[model samples]
Target: MEAQRDRLVTLCRDAGIGQAELLADTLSLLLEGARVSVQSVGTEGPSARLSAC
Candidate 1:
């Protein structure tokens, strides 16, 4: 995860990505993981945050 974050930061830097766009996208996997993990425990929370890859 640490390596992936570093790569993402590097990729964004190299590609000149804006902070807002990055934040909007970076949380996609977070929400996905949260949703999938919750399914295993048989519980659902309020609407999850939306994000794009």
Candidate 2:
């Protein structure tokens, strides 16, 4: 997971995102929340709603 986060950070940096680490962290949390939401409330849960943003 750490390696994947590092890779995401690199990608974000390459894309010129100044806050690459924050982007990576946000993406990680979003994914984790989606997974948990799916487990707890199917696909159309709060995470899915949040992702629509």
Candidate 3:
């Protein structure tokens, strides 16, 4: 997870995005939330909307 986050941060930074760390963290949280949501409520639940975001 740490490695993935680091890669995300590097990618964001290379793309010249400001607050790369924060963006990576936010993405991580969103993904984790989606995983939990899917596990608890199945793919047809609210987690399905995550792809629309």
TM-scores, one per candidate: 0.40, 0.69, 0.75
Please write out the lDDT profile of model 2 over residues 1-53, one tens digit for every residue.
78878988999999999999999999887767776887789867777776686
Q: What's the residue-level lDDT of 50 in candidate 3?
A: 86
Highest-scoring model, lDDT: 3
Instruction: State in Å the error of residue 43, model 2.
Output: 4.8
Q: Write the per-residue lDDT of candidate 1 for residues 1-53, one digit (tens) a residue.
A: 55656666677777777773475357556655766765674454422332221
- The whole-model C-alpha lDDT of candidate 1 against the native structure comes to 0.57
Count of residue pairs whose backbone atoms collide, per candidate: 0, 0, 0
Model 2: per-residue Cα lDDT at residue 4: 77
Q: Rate the local accuracy (lDDT) of all candidates.
A: 0.57, 0.85, 0.89
Q: How far in Å is the alpha carbon of 34 misplaced in model 2?
A: 0.8
Query: Taking the tens digit of each residue's C-alpha lDDT, what string does model 3 give over 15-46?
Result: 99999999999988878888789888998988
* Model 2 bad stretches (over 4 Å): 43-53
